[model samples]
Target: MAQTGWDDGQALIPPDMYTDWTAVALLLLTAAPLAIVVGTAGFFIWKQKRSSQR
Candidate 1:
């Protein structure tokens, strides 16, 4: 008889699920500043409208 050392079994992950981390990170970076710029502009516009109404 011969010994095969050990067996670790099959992998848990499926083969079709791949991710592109670089693109995800780049998207997050771009979204954060764009969100801030749009939010600031909206706030100032709202303030201007409020002050004009008084």
Candidate 2:
């Protein structure tokens, strides 16, 4: 049977998972603002082209 005591070296098990919530939140926040700006600029450019074509 396997040992079941603190001195058995079980504490050496590596962590199975890790999460960086702050980095995720920062990426999401930055992407949203950049997307909004790019979308708005694209819309204006399309409108100007349509008007110029008339």
Candidate 3:
């Protein structure tokens, strides 16, 4: 028999699992917008409070 070069212990992702990446990407996409909106609101509120304290 010819030598099969790959090691038996190597890890590989099968093609069917590729869709899992898309699901994760969608989750991040949803989270990013929410985070941006919350951050912006918090920054504005902080600035308003700081200016009012003078």
- The C-alpha lDDT values of all candidates are 0.82, 0.85, 0.81
Candidate 3 Cα lDDT to native: 0.81
Q: In angstroms, what RMSD does candidate 1 have relative to the true structure?
A: 7.7
Instruction: Give the runs in model 1 whose Cα sits over 4 Å from its true position.
Output: 1-14
In model 3, the worst 10-residue window by lDDT is 6-15
TM-score per candidate, chains pooled: 0.69, 0.68, 0.62
Tens digits of per-residue lDDT, candidate 2, 1-54, equal 774554466766445546789999999999999999999999999999999999
Q: On residues 1-54, what C-alpha lDDT tens digit does candidate 1 reach at each position?
A: 563333334545545557889999999999999999999999999999999999
lDDT of 1 at 14: 47
* Highest-TM-score candidate: 1
Give the total clashing residue pairs for model 3: 0
- Give the range where candidate 2 is weakest over 10 consecutive residues by summed lDDT: 6-15
Candidate with the larger lDDT of 1 and 2: 2
- Model 1 weakest lDDT span, ten residues long: 3-12
lDDT of 3 by residue, 1-54 (tens): 674444344647543444678889999999999999999999999999999999
Query: What TM-score, to 2 decimals, does candidate 1 have?
Result: 0.69
RMSD of each: 7.7, 7.4, 5.2
